[model samples]
Each structure stands twice: as C-alpha cells, then as structure tokens.
Target chain A: MSFVRAEGIFQSYGRRPILERVDVSVKEGEFISIVGASGCGKSTFLRLLLAQERPTRGEIRIAGAPPATEPGLDRGVVFQRYSVFPHLTVRENIVAGESFRTRWGRFGGAARRAALARADETLARIGLDHVAHQYPATLSGGMQQRLAIGQALAARPRILLLDEPFGALDPGTRLTMHDFLSELRTETGMTVFMVTHDLAEGFKLGDRVLVFDKPRWDPTDPDAYGATITYDFDARNGGIPFQTPEETLHALRTPGPDPVA
Target chain B: MRWINRQPGTALRAALVATPFLLLFLAYWIGSEIRLAANPSDRLLPAPGTIAATAERLFTEPDRRSGQILLWHDTLASLLRLTAGVAIAAAVATVAGLAIGLLPHVRAALAGLVAVVSMIPPLAVLPILFIVFGLGELSKVVLIVIGILPFLIRDLSQRVLEIPRETIVKAETLGASSGVIALRVALPQLLPRLIQAVRLSLGPAWLFLIASEAISADQGLGYRIFLVRRFLAMDVILTYVIWITLLAFLMDLALRWLSRRLFPWAEAGL
Candidate 1:
C-alpha cells in the first residue's frame, strides 16, 4: 500500500489555480523529489502535505489520516532555513519532536532525563554529540540544518517531509547535505517527500519526481499560471537501474518542460 | 587571550580614552569648588566636595534624619518598591508580549489599548493612584506598574511579533507543538530583544519611582532628594541623585551581564 496518496489535488488562490488534478503516491521507504521552475507550485504542494495550506479539492493520507489542524509526531519536517531553536542546546532541539517520548517534561526530574537522553542519542546520530550543549546561533548554517533534520527524525516519525532543506546552504554545503541525507535515508529507510525548484535536485534526491505547475497569476490573462500536474514517476524503480536526464526526458513525453511529462 | 594581554599599549589606549573625560570632570569639580568658596554665603554654588561628604555620611552614619542615615532607609525602600514593581511589570509584560506577539488577533485587539496606555505618562498617574490607594507604598507601587506596563507590553510584543515567521514554521514541521514553538522556537529568538526592552523599562521604572516618592510617604531615594531640597542642602540632593543614577547604571550593567550569559552571540550591544 502507498504510504502517502493524493488524488485530484486542486488548489487555487483567488481563482488562480496552483495545482489542478495533481495526483501523487509514494511507497514506504521511498525518497521522492518534486522539482519545477520557480513558479511551479512545488513549495505549495509541500505546504499542502505539511498542512500549512490545504488543497481546494483532493484527498491526502499520511500513514493513516491526512494532516490536520493540530500537528502530530507522525510527520517530521525540515525547512530550507534551519529552524532549530536558537537559544536551546543542540540536544534540546533534537528531542523537541519527542512529545511521545517524554510523557512529563513539565513534571521535570526523571522524565526530563529520559527526554534529554533521547536528545543525546539523536545528536550522536547527526555527528553533533560534541556540540550538544551549543546553541543554534553558534552553529554553522550546515550544522544547524543538520540539527534541524536530526530534530525531525528524533521521534522516529513514519514520514519525513522536506521543503528545499538545502536551498539556503552554500553549493558545497548543499551537496554535502544531499550525500549525508541519502546515506541517512538508507540507514533510517524513511519515506521522504522533498520539494525543490532545481531540476538537478529532483534528479539527485527524489525517488519519484512529482511536478506541480501553477499556470499563472495574471488576471488580465485569465489562463496564466494555469495550475497543472505536469507529470509523476517512480523515480527509483520504474524501469532503469538508475535513470538519467536522457531517460527521464524520454520518460516525460509531454509537451511541457517537466521530466515526468 | 593573546589580544587581551596586560600590554602597555592597551593601558596607554585605555588612559588615552579616559584622560580627556577625567580632566574635564576635574575641571568642573575644581571650578565648582572655587565658585562655592569664592562666595561662602552663596546659596547656588554648592561645592562638589559637599556632595561627596553627604554621600559618605549617608553611607556610613546613615541616620541623618532623626538619627537615621537617610541612605539606608531610602535605598531599602526604593529598592523594595522598584523590585515589586518591575517584577510585576515583567510578568505582565512577558504574558502580554507573548500573547500579542504570537497571535495576530490578540495583537490587533490590544494594540489600541497599548497605544492609549503608552500615551499616558506614568508619573501622570500619581494623582489618581494617590487618590485610589492613598499616599502609601500601595499607591506608589500601583503607579509604577501603571507607568511601566504600557511601555513594556507595547515594545516587547512588537519585538516578539517581529521574530521570523519562517523559523516558527520550521520548528512546527519538526513536530513541535504550539507551546514548544512559542517557548522554544519563538521565545529564544525574542529573548535578546525582550532583554533589551527590559533594560529600557528599568529606566522608566526608576524615573516613575522618583516621581511617586517625591510626593508619597517618605522613605525612598526620591523622598531623600525632596527632603534635602527643603533645607537647600544640594549636597544631600546631589548625593541622592547620584545614588539613584548609580543604582540605575548598576541595574543596567547587571542586565547586560545576564543577557550576555543568556545569548553570548547576541548582537544588539550596550
């Protein structure tokens, strides 16, 4: 069964459609990258998945129920800009997602110690155990982002959601994050859905590339940025052992600029 | 450590910075002394030494009034009032700041009240407070709260609101609940700013204390200043003024130190 499923996703802002009839599906332990041009509504789709924004029409399921008004530990997220707690120790942030773990941090004492211990192991996994006591403001951008990713994974969520997690980093840092993430993914075997405007990112990361095409925002030309689902593909195992741009190009036979056409 | 050495160059630079100000202050002190001595009977030109002597007396034999060293009585009283006032103000400021800063609806609702409150000078509330609570510590404390709360809430709330929205969203995606997002994500970003706002609030806190003390039941730094004013003892008045200012400076220093401890990387400096 698909770990995530979205069908007939239609989203619009003031009559300007962002995603129309966009369908997406991801299996367990799959890594899917959504890529498109700047206005491709890639972030919007991610936002929908995050429940930051809801689709005008469609259904989305994450493990079980779709995301709701209240956030749950089942879905973990990493943003482009590392949103680690600036004043908190790296350990505190890593355990931030473990609501299910520390039943009573408010009560303090032993429960809090357990929570701190959970945070400790997470920092260890992220190779930041040495800096566990350091604050995010003191950390390098890459380190902070790594902490953010670690924090999201702390509770061992069913799905990890990423929205251009490497977009804010320098090119070198971005590549490093990609490699680290791919390796981490292998160890964790998580289902990830990442959004990026760079086509290269789509090629590098996502197990399945899903493109969201927002038609246009111009009201004068009513049909501008018309929202459409350009294409979808099983980026990991559709056909070739490893799919390259040529194969992706051949796979996307549609008239648009999308590879999954 | 290399740069922070006890080098002659550092000392010379330090002396260079202090030389001009020190000389200027000496000139003023000497000038005032000369002017006061030139007219021993004169009421206006009180010698700087007189103020120093009064400060010494207040510090040592504090029983200047009815065998009571006014410093002990007044500093103790003023500190008690200020502590209670600022602590209450901190609680109010923090809660209001967090609420308005976090919620748009709360912000919109409270902005107008905050605006109206900010417009009213805290000292101006002395009359009403005196009438309501009498010329007692109660009135004084209430006045201080009234005077300080508006400025506290308005500034801290605005600062809290100014925290980057993207950061909050990022934390939420990391499975942080609303409380965690505000306290962990939003609060830390707002901390350095809140510390700044508290520093600013302390100034007004003391200013209001003096205004209230000048009129209320007599046992604060402001009361000391006022009573000395009646006897034309500029020494006592000046000493008290210096005392109050020094206290404010110390409070500011302590706050700066605490802030540094909390966020060593904080940029908004003294």
Candidate 2:
C-alpha cells in the first residue's frame, strides 16, 4: 500500500475551480516533484498535501491514516521566501523548530541546552555555524533558504514539502542549494513533495515527476476548467519523454465542453 | 552633485540638523526683541531670558499655599496618569489585536465595532466619560485610553495580519498549538510593533491628557498651564511647553532604543 494517497481530490475557491479529479499515490521516501504551467494548481496540490487547505472533494491519507486537519509535526514545509522567522537568531530559529515537540513550544534549562547543541550541529551540517548568532536578513538568499530547510528538518518530520524552494536564488546559489538538498535527502531518506517551475530541477531531484494540466479548456473563459495530473513520469531512469515540452501546450490546445449560450 | 545621493559627514549632518532649529530660535528671538522694544510689559510673547528665569523658578521654588514645588508636582501627576493610561491601553490592545488578527470569529465580532468607535471624536465623549467615571484620575486616564486605544488596536492588528502566512503555517507544521502560536510565534513579532504604535500614538495621548486636564484637573502640567492662562503668564506657559516637548522626545527616544536592544533582528526591515 502506498504511504501517501489522494483519491479524486477537487479544490476551488468559490466557483473558480483550481483543481479537479486529481489522484496520486506515493511510496514512503519517494521524492515527488510537481511541475506545471503557472496557475495549474501545482502549489494548490502541495497545500493540500500540507493540509494547509482541504480539498473541496476527496481525502488525503498519509501512512494509512487521514492527515491532520491542520499542518502538524508529521509534515514540514519550506517556501521560496519568508520561510525563516525574522525575529529569531539563526540558532534560535533552529531551536524554535525543535521546541515545537514540547508542550509549551519552547525549551528551557537542560532541554534548551540540548536543543542549542543540536541546532549548532545542524548549523555546522548546513555550513551556517559562522552566522548562527545573526538574523535571517544578514544571510544571502542561498544561506537563508539553507537555514529554512535546516529549520524544517530540525523536527525530523516524516514528510518534507518544498514549494519552489530555490526559485528565488541566483543560478549559482540554486545549484548549491540543489546539492545541499540532495545530500540531506540521502541522509534522511524522508518523503518529499516539491513544487517547481523549473523542469530540469524537478527531474533532477524527484523520483517521480508529476505534470499538472487541464485536459479540458475553454478558450472563451480560461478558468472555466481546472487542472489535473496529466502525466506522471518516472524520473529515476532517464524516463522523461522528449515530447514532455509539448505536453502543456498540447493540453492548452485541447477544447472543453460547449460554453453556455 | 545630486544632493539626494550625497552622504553628509558627521559634522555636516550635525550642522544640517541644527539649521532648522537655529532658524526658528533666531526668528523667535528677533520677534521677542521687537515686541519687548514696543511694549516692555507685553505678556503675549515673553523674552527668552524671562521664560528661562520662570522655568528655573518653577523647577526650584515651592508653592506658598501647598508648600510643594508645583512644576515637579504637576509633572509627576501628569506622568503617572500618562503611564497608567498608556500601559493599560498597550496591554488590552495587544491581546485584542492578536485575537482579531489571528482568529476569524473574533475579527468578525469586533473589527467593525472598533472601526466605528475609532471614528467618534474622543473629545465629544469626554463629558460622557466625566459623567460615567467621574472627574477623578480614572476619567483622565480613561480619556487617554479612549483617545488612543483604537489606533493602537488597529495598528497592532494590521501588523499582526502583515505577518507572513508562511510563518504561521510553518509554526503549525512544527506542532504548535493556538496558544503557543500566540505566545511563541505572534507575541515576539508584536512587541516591537507595540512600542512603535505607542510611540506613534503618544502625540494624541498627550493631546487627550492635556485636554482632559485643562477641562477639569486639580494638579497637572496641563492644569498649571491653563490655570496661569488667565494671568497671561506666558513665560510659565512657554516653559511648560518646552518641558513637555523635551519629555515627549525623550520618551520616544527611549522606546526606540529599547526596541532596537530587544529585537535587533527587526531593525533591518523596520
């Protein structure tokens, strides 16, 4: 049985359908990369997985049980920006992540000392130990994203969700971050669902790359239809098709049901 | 050179900062000299020396009847009331703002009401407050709170709302409860903002305090100023005005310093 499963999920804001008839299943520790054209419900699907928002229809199950109604310790997420707490020092931010395990959401005395030690180790691993006392604003974009990922991983969540985590970095920084993420994945072997606009990054990091597109479209009203999983490419064995570039364009070319008179 | 981009050196910056103040002082001095030349007993615009001497006397001398230094007595009274009003308002506003900003139900219940209340001129409600709370310290303090509480609540709530959705979601994913989110996640971010709101609303707070004192008060800086107004004691009034401005500036400076010391991280963005 799959560790993560979504059956016939549909999501919309009011009458505007963002996603419809979306189904996916993933084995434990499999990195699933979600890629699509802009406004194709890619982040919406990630949000569903995070349980930040529930689907309009259908349910998602993680590890044989329904996920928490709200985001919880089982899952951790990193966004492209504003992921780190601006008010906390780098060391404190990592400590904050681990502190959530406690009832009060803070550490003190011996536990706090232990948490600080663990945070130091994390900073060392992420190559950010030098600036552990500094704020997030002082760090370069790559460093901040690194801290964010480190902070997310501090709790050792079963599933790590990344929403275009490297979309804001420069090309050089992006490459380093990719390598950092790859190393972390190899170390933890945790389940990951990443949404990305860059297809190459998706293929490189994901075990299975899912393409989201609307099979039906209304040329007269663009938002008349919602996007669904159009293709699920096995990314592990160089299996991505050469025609994948045309997949989205092809979906756009497809026509929808007749518009109301 | 485009002056916009020019970085002033320390000495130059000091001179630049002093220019407007110097110009204003010079103008005041010139006007006072001309008025004094025409009418030596003119109480409308006292000479700078006369104001300074009055300030010295007010600061050092005791009142004949009460045997208490009136300036010190008035300042202490006013400061106590201002502190109590501002402190209470800050506490209430923080909690209410957090609730309104984070919880949808609370926001729905109170946001519009607060907006409506904020619109009503506080002075217009002064008589009603006097009637309700009486002319004691409570009424005076209540006036200050009523004058500035809405603005503080609105500002703090807006600031709380401005906190990135990602930060809150991230905290939740880490297994924080609503209380924990309010305490650990939201409270730290709001403290500096509270200080800023207080600093911003101080002007109105002082305005309310003075207005209330002027209307009805036995002992306060505002009371003293209004009391001597009938005698046209311009020197004493001018002394009080300068003293009040200095106190307000110092309070603002202290709060700013505290905010920086407490949350050095916020300095970059704030």
lDDT of each: 0.76, 0.92
Q: In model 2, which runs have C-alpha deviations exceeding 4 angstroms?
A: A240-261, B1-13
Against the hidden true structure, what lDDT does model 2 obtain? 0.92
**TM-score, cand. 2:** 0.93
Give fnat, all candidates.
0.39, 0.79
Question: Residue B225: error of model 2 in Å?
Answer: 0.2
lDDT of 2 by residue, B76-153 (tens): 999999999999999999999999999999999999999999999999999999999999999999999999999999
Best by TM-score: 2
The two-chain DockQ for each candidate, comma-separated, is 0.35, 0.59
Query: In order, how many clashes per candidate?
Result: 15, 0
lDDT per residue, candidate 1, A61-121, as tens digits? 8876744653456778888774565666777776666652333323267767988887787
In order of the candidates, what TM-score does chain B achieve? Answer: 0.86, 0.97
Docking class for candidate 2? medium
